[model samples]
Target chain A: GLAAPAIAQENPKISWRLTSSFPKSLDTIYGGAEDIAKHLEAATDGNFTIQPFAAGEIVPGLQAVDAVTANTVEMAHTCSYYFWGKDPTYAIGTAIPFGLNGRLQNSWFYQGNGNTLMNEFYATQGIYGLPAGNTGAQMGGWFRKEINTVDDLKGLKMRIAGMAGKIVEKLGVIPQQIAGGDIYPALEKGAIDAAEFVGPYDDQKLGFEKVAKYYYYPGWWEGGPVVHAFINLEKWNSLPKHYQAALTDACAFANTNMMARYDMKNPQALKQLVANGAELRPFSQEILEACYAAALSVYEEISASNATFKKIYDDQLAFKKDAYLWMQLSEYTFDTFMMIQQRAGKL
Target chain B: GLAAPAIAQENPKISWRLTSSFPKSLDTIYGGAEDIAKHLEAATDGNFTIQPFAAGEIVPGLQAVDAVTANTVEMAHTCSYYFWGKDPTYAIGTAIPFGLNGRLQNSWFYQGNGNTLMNEFYATQGIYGLPAGNTGAQMGGWFRKEINTVDDLKGLKMRIAGMAGKIVEKLGVIPQQIAGGDIYPALEKGAIDAAEFVGPYDDQKLGFEKVAKYYYYPGWWEGGPVVHAFINLEKWNSLPKHYQAALTDACAFANTNMMARYDMKNPQALKQLVANGAELRPFSQEILEACYAAALSVYEEISASNATFKKIYDDQLAFKKDAYLWMQLSEYTFDTFMMIQQRAGKL
Candidate 1:
C-alpha cells in the first residue's frame, strides 16, 4: 500500500526547447547544448525535458540572440560576442583580446564576479546566460604565408570574431565575421587571407590545414572564449527550483566535458596538421607588439563610451593581475621548462 | 642585410621551467600549461623563462613526484591523486565515500586537499601535492552494500573515504580507510563504516580509501572524480630539463592535469596498501537485489577486467552516447516550445 501510494503521486512533467548556434559538425561545442537537454530530462526523472535545434534549422545562425530576445525560442546556445553589434559589453561575456584564458575565465565567472557581472549585462539585452562551454585559449589564425612583421597584417583580410575584429581593424587589417561552416570555403577561394578558430582540434576538423600552410600562435583576440546558454529570463524564472538547479548543474558538466574532449582530440590533430605541411609559426615580435598596443587603445575607446563594459572590464583586469602573479610563481615556471625540453627533443 | 643577420642569429635567450605530464598543457588539458608559461615568458621577454616537468617529475612522484620531482623550488601546484599512500587517497584526492558534497569537496580540495593530501600522502613521506583543482564526478563508492534485507553487511568493515563512512556503514557499519592524514585518526578511533578513494584520482593518493569501502562501483566506483599530483620521484628527477620540462609540463599540466595527476598519483599509493584495508567488496544478492537486479549485474563488470574498460566504456557509457541520443529529441522538443514563449526566465 505504501509503495503504491507513493507511486501514484508523481511529479508533473515539463518540457523545453533549445536552439544551438553551432552545426553538429563541431560536436563538442554543439554537443554541449544536447547534453544539457539530456541531463535535465534524466535528473528530473522525465518530469522536465528540453529539445535542441542546430544553427539555421529553426532560425538563421547569427540570429540566435535576437530570437531568444524576441521570444522566438525558449533558449539558445551561442557565444555572447556574436551579439556585440548590439552592445560591446557582450564581448566580455564571451572573450576579449588578451583577456583571461579558460581556467581563469571560469574562476572569474564562478569564483569571481564574472557570472554575476556578465548576467547583469545580459539582462539589459533581455536574456540570462549560463557558461555552457569554452574553447580554452585560441590560435591566432591560419595564414597563407608566414607573418614576419607588422606590415604583413596591413591589407590582409581576416575572419575574426567579435571585438577582436575592431582591434585588428585599428591595425589597418580588414576583419570579417563569418560562421564556422563558411570559413573553409572563403579561405580556399582566397576570399579571406586568414581565419581564427578554437585551437588545433577544431581547426583541423574544419580542414584549415589544407588551405592555409602557416598556422600562427596565440589567438590574442580570444585568450579564453566562453560559449553560453542564453535562456529566456521569464521562462527561466518560471521553472521549478529543482529544474533550475538541474540545468545549472548540467551546464557545469557540459562545460568541463567540452574542454576535456578538445584536450584529447587536439594533439593528434595538431600532429596531423603539421604532417600535412601546416607550418606552425610564432607571431612576429613586431606584430605582437603592435597588436598589444592596438588592444590597449581599443580598450580605452570602449571604456570611454560604455559604462557597463568598463565596470566588468575593470574587475576582470584586476582579477587577471592577481591570477597572473600567482601563476608566474607556479604554472609559469613549470611550463617554461617543459617547452624548452620539447624543442630540444629530450622530453 | 647585415643588421638582419645579426638579429636573426641573436636567438633570444629564452628559457622556462614547465611542470607537466605532456610536453605542454595546451589542447586544454596540457595546452593551458604550455600557453601560460610560453605567453608569460614571451610577454616579459627572455627575462622570464618557465621550465616544465612531466608526471614522474624530474624522476617520478613514486620516485619523488612533487616540486621535489622537478626541483623548481619556486613552487609546485597540482592535484593529489599521484601519491596515494604515505597516507590514504582521501587526504589528497576528494573521491572518497559519500565524501564532502560536491561543492564542499571543491572547498575541501582547495582548502583541504592542500593540507590533508599533502600532509598525509606527501609531506610525511617527503613529497608534496596541492589542490590545484578538480574534475567533479564521483558516484557513491561502488558498493557491495547488501540490501536484499539490509542486515547482510553487518561487521563488513570495508575501505571507504571521507564522510560516506557514517552514512552507508550506518546500516550495520564498519567503515575504514580514511586517507593518509585522516586514516590514522579514524582507523585508530574505529570510526569508519567502509571507504573508497578513487579509480585513479585518489587511488595513488593511496588505496587506504579502498581499505574499508570494499571498492565497489559502476566506478559507479567513480562516475567522475578529481585527480592529484604527487611530487618526489627523485624530487621529480633532479630537475632542469627546464626543471625537467617545468616538472614535466607541471605534471603535463596536472595531467588532464587533474586526471593525469590522479593516474600518476594512484599507482604507487595503491601499491603501498597491499597489507592495509585492501579487500574488494562484492555486491551481495540482498544488497544487489535491493539496489537493482539489473543494476547489480548490468554494471559492465565484463569490461571491468580487460581492454574493454579502455575501449567500450567511452563509447557506451562516457555520457556522450546516451546524452547524444536523448538530447536529439527531448531537448529539441522542449526548447522549441520554450523559446517561442517570450516570458521564459533567462539564466
Candidate 2:
C-alpha cells in the first residue's frame, strides 16, 4: 500500500510556457493545450500557470519536439508523427498505416504496454509525454479527381507525412512533406495533386472543398491520430509528484475533450462540405488492399533495422489482433446491424 | 478570458472515504476507484486522501446511492443504472438498450448536453456526479443453452438489470434481479438460467463458464456502462474550488483507465474461457430484432411517465442519430474494411 505522506501546507507558484505545433486557425487541435492549462491552473488554485503559443510563435511547428528536448521550452503540444523524420518509432505514437483506432489507441496507451514504451522512447529524447488529444479517424485526403483503382494512386503527388508517405512511395505516388501552414497554398497552387489534413471539421476550415471536390473516406495512414504534450524530461521530474499527477490528470481531460469536440463538429462540417459540392467517396477496394500489402512490407523492413521500433510495434500488433477480433464479434456486429437497420429506416 | 487571480500558498489537510459497488477481488472494476484516489492524493500533495471500501464493507453494493444521498459516506463509486429503481433516468447516466458505445458515451457526457442534464438531475438527489470509469461494451451474458430465436427467450429466467429487464418481459422472458455474490450460485443451481454481469474478465473470475457453456456477446443494454463517483452535494460544495478541480480531473483519469484496463484484460480472459470449453455465440438475428422492438416501446412508455426521463432521453436520441450517421460513414466503414482484411490475413 502506498500511504500518503503528511500534507505540507507550503506551496510555491510556478509558471511555464507551452509551444504548440498547431496554428490558432485550428481551434480544436490547438485548444487542447489551452484546455490542459486551464484545468491545471484551476486544479492548483492558480499556483501553476502555463501559457500556450501557436506554431512559429516560439519555434516552427515541426521543431516543437526539438524545442522541448533542448530545454529551450518547458512543454509542447504537437502530433508525435511530425517527429518521425528523426525516428520512425514516433509515428507509432501518433498513428500508423492501418493502426489502432482512437478507442484502441487509448486502450493501448493507458492499459497495455504503450504508455511505458512511448515514455521510455521519449526519455531517450530528453522528453516526457502525455496524450493531450486524438483526432479519431481522419479523411483520406482531398483530391482533384476521384480514385477508382490502384492505378489512380500511381504517380499521384500528395502532401502527407510519417510512415504513410514512405508506404505510398511504393504505390508510385510522389510524397510531398509540407508543413501544416503551407499545405493549403501547396494544394491550391496544384503543387500537390492531393493533401490529407485532419477530417471534415479542420478540412472545411482550410477550404479544401473549394480546391478539391473529391473527399475520400478513411485516412488509413492516420486513424486515431494522437496529439500529445512533450515536456522536458528534467523539468517534468523536477516538479513534485503532486504536480505531476495534476498535469497528467489535466492531460486526460483534454484527451477526451478533443475527440468529443471533433465528433460534434465534424458531422455538421461534413454536411456543409457536401452542400458546398464536395464529393464523399470510400477508397476503392483495390487501393486499400494494395496499401495494406505495402504497409505490411514497410513495417517488416523498418522493424528489421530498429530494435526499439520492433519492440513497440510488435506489442501493438498483438494487441490490435486481439482487439479487432473482439470488436468484430461485439462492436462491429452491433454497429453493422444498426447501420443497416438505420439505412432501411427501421431504427 | 478567465485569468488566474493569484496563487495562494496555504492549504488544509483533508481525508475522505469512497465506497465502491465492486469487490476488491475484481481489480479491474474496483481498481478504478483506487486510480482516482491515487491520482487525487498525488494531485493534492497528500493533503487529501480517499480511502476506498468494497461493497458490503460500508453499505451493501446497491445501497451506495442512498448512502451518498444520506451522507453515510462522502462519496461512492457504482453503476448509475443500479439506481434506476429510484429513477429510470439514472439508467441513462450509465447506459440504455442500444445506447451510445464507450466513445460516444464520453462524447455525450463531456461534449454534448449529457453533463449538464445529468448534473441537473443529480442536484435533485442532493448529489454531484462525475464519470469516473467505463466498462466498454459487455457480453450479453452466459447462458446454459444457445438462443436461436425469440421463442428461445420465452419463459427464460435471467438475471439482468436496468430497463433491459422490462423489455425482456415483453418477450415473455422472466427477468430476475440478483445480487453480485448470489448470482453465480443462483445460476449454478438453475434458479436463473442466464446471467449478465460484465465482460469476460470479471465473468471468468466468477467462474460462470463452468456452469454455463454458452457465452453470448454484444450486450445491447450496456454498450458502454459508465460507473461514476457520487459525492454528497453538500460536501462537494464545501470543498475549495482547487480541491473540486482536483477531484474532477482525477475522475477523468480514471474514466480512461477503466475502459483501457478492461480492453487489455478481457481478450486474454475470453480466450482462456473458450479454451475451457465455453462456446462463443452471437445472439440470433430474430432475438435481437425482437429485443430492439421491445426496447423502443419500453423507452416510450417510461418517457411518457417521467418528464425527466423524456428530456434526457430526447437529447441522447438526437445525439445518437447524428453520431451514428457520422460513424457509419467514417469509423464503421474503416473498421469494417480493415477488420475484413485482417481476417483474410491481409492487414
Candidate 3:
C-alpha cells in the first residue's frame, strides 16, 4: 500500500535497463527475467520499456549485488543467497538446505512474516527485494556415481550453490561455487565430480544427463529456490504508486509463471532423461543423515556468530517444525498411500 | 522412473473411508486430498486409515448421463454442465451471463450449482448433483451467441447457466436444462439460453468443459467458471475406480483443487493462465462481432418471447460486451509488457 505520485501522466514512456544472473541458454530460468521485460512493456502500453543484459555483460554474475548496491545498475534479478559470501544471513532469503518448499515459502512471505524480514535484510544492502520467481524443490545434483553411503561424499569435489555448500563441506567434500554456464564444463572435465543445477527439465537442457550418469534426488540443499528482483532502494522509492503496484503484481505473476513452466516441463524431461540412460538415484540414508547433521551444525554455527542470521533462522526453524508436523500427518499419509498404490500398479 | 515393486509391507493398523475423483491426491491438485486425509488420519494415526475411493465410486457422475440416465443413486460431487440434459446444454455448467465471478461461484457452487443444477433439476426427476468442487473456465456454450448490433437476438434462448440466466435471456430469453444430476429439467425447462462449462480443467473434469467451451477464444461465455461432479452414472460405474480417480481427481482434486488451489499453491498458475489465456483470447473484432451478434439476436428473441424476461434484458445486454474487449487488450498488453520486463529485469 505504499503509494507515490504519478511519474508522468498520459502513460509516460520510460525505458529501464536490467541485468540478469543467468545465461540466455537456460531459457526457463533466464527466460523468467526476459518475460518480465516483455510483460512490463505490454502492460504499460509500450509507454515503459526495459532493456535486459545477460550475466557478465554488466558485471560478473556473482557480483550483481555489488553492482546494484553501488548503483552501477538501476536493478538486478538474481538469487539473494549467492551473496552469502558477504553475509550468511542472505542465504535464508533465497533458500536454505532442506528448508521450506516453494508453497511454504510463499506462505512464509505472503502469509507469514517472510517478506517483511527479507525486505529488512535488503535495506541493509541499499536495495528493494521482490521474489520474482522460484524453482520449486530442486533435484539434488548430477553425480558421476551413485551416492550409496556417507563415505562417498568424502573428498568429492562438487559445484554446488548457496549454503548447502557449507553443509557438504562438513562431510569433507570440497564445494566449488560456479556460475550456471560454467557448471557443465567444470563437471565434464573432472573439475568437479558433481553439480546440482535444478530439476530434470533444466538439468537436461544444460546437458548434464550426457556427462552425469547417476542423478540423485532429494535436493537437500535447495528445497525451494527463489529468484529476486533487486531494485535500487532510491529508484524504488521514486516510482509512482501505480507503477510500483504494477511492478509488484508483475513480479508475482512472473514468480508463478516460472514454477508452472517447470512443473509442466519437468515431467516430460524426467521421462526423457531416463530414456536417455540418465539414472535417477536416491541418496542413501547414511548420506541423507550425514547431510542433515551437517546442516544442523552449520545452522548452530551461524546462529552463534551472526545475530541477524539467528533471528531469521530461529523463526524459520520453528515455522518449519510446525509445518512438517502438519504435513506429516496429512500430506505424508496420502502421498505414501498413493505412491504405494502407484508402485503396486493399483493406480 | 523409480518404479519399485510393491512389497508385502504391513499396512498401518488403521482404516477410514475417504472419497474423491482421484485415488489419492499426490501433487498439487491431488495434494489437497492427500493433505486433508493424511492430516485427518495422522491426527489419529493408529486409530484411522482412510480408505480412498476414486470416481465412479458407488456411482458414475458421468452416467448421471445414463442412470439419472436410469434413476439411481444418492449424493454426487460434480459440475452442473455434465448433464446438458433432457433439454438445452446450459443447465449443466456454471458461467453464462456475464457469468458468476470465480469467487462468487465458489459461493454459488458450494451454495448455488448445488441448488440450481441439482435441486431444481433433480427434484423434477429422481437424482441429485452436488457442487463438491469447481475448475473455473467455462466456454461460452460454444457460442451460437450471434450478437450483431445487439438487435439480432430476437427469439434465441441459448443454453446459458447460473446468473447468466438474467442477462442473456433479456433480449428474448429462453433457459433450460437440468443438473449434471438433473440436466433434463429445463432442456426439459424449454428452448433455453446458451450454456457453457469449463475448459480443459473441468471439461476433463466433466468431460465437457472442452467440448462445450470449444468456441474457444474469449470464452466470453465464461471468463472462468466452476464445475460440479454429477452422480448416478449408474451408481457411478459401481463404485471402485469410478469414485476413485474421477470423483477424487475431479471433485476432490481436479475440480475443487485445480484452479484456486493451483492459484494459491502453485507459484506459476497465473503466469501460465496469462500465457495460455493470450493464445486463447486473441483480439479479433470479427470474432467478437459474431459472438456479440449471436448474443444480441438471442437476446431479442428472448425479450420478445417472454415479457417478464424482457424487463431486465436491456441493462444486462448493455453491460455484456461493454468493456470486455477493451479490458482484454488493455490488461493483455500491460501483462505482456510486465512479463517482458521481468525476464529482462534480471538481466
Q: Native contacts recovered by candidate 3, as a share?
A: 0.00
DockQ of each: 0.02, 0.48, 0.02
Please report how far candidate 1 places residue B334 from its true position, in Å: 40
Q: What does the i-RMS of model 2 come to?
A: 4.2
lDDT of 3 by residue, A134-202 (tens): 776677788987778888889999988668887888898898978777888888898899998877777
Residue B47's C-alpha lDDT in candidate 1? 33
Q: Where does model 2 sit among the CAPRI classes? A: acceptable
Top candidate, metric TM-score? 2
**Candidate 2 collision pairs:** none
Error of 3 at B25 (Å): 28
Write the residue-wise lDDT of candidate 2 on B269-314 in tens digits.
8889999999989888888889999999998999899999999999
Q: Mark the 10 consecutive residues where model 2 chain B has the least summed lDDT.
A: B1-10
Q: Runs in model 3 with CA error above 4 Å? A: A1-11, A329-347, B1-347
Worst 10 residues of 3 chain B by lDDT: B2-11
| RMSD after CA superposition, every candidate | 24.6, 3.6, 23.6
lDDT (0 to 1) per candidate: 0.55, 0.88, 0.54
**Model with the higher TM-score, candidate 1 or 3:** 1
The TM-score that candidate 2 achieves is: 0.96
Ranking by lDDT: 2, 1, 3
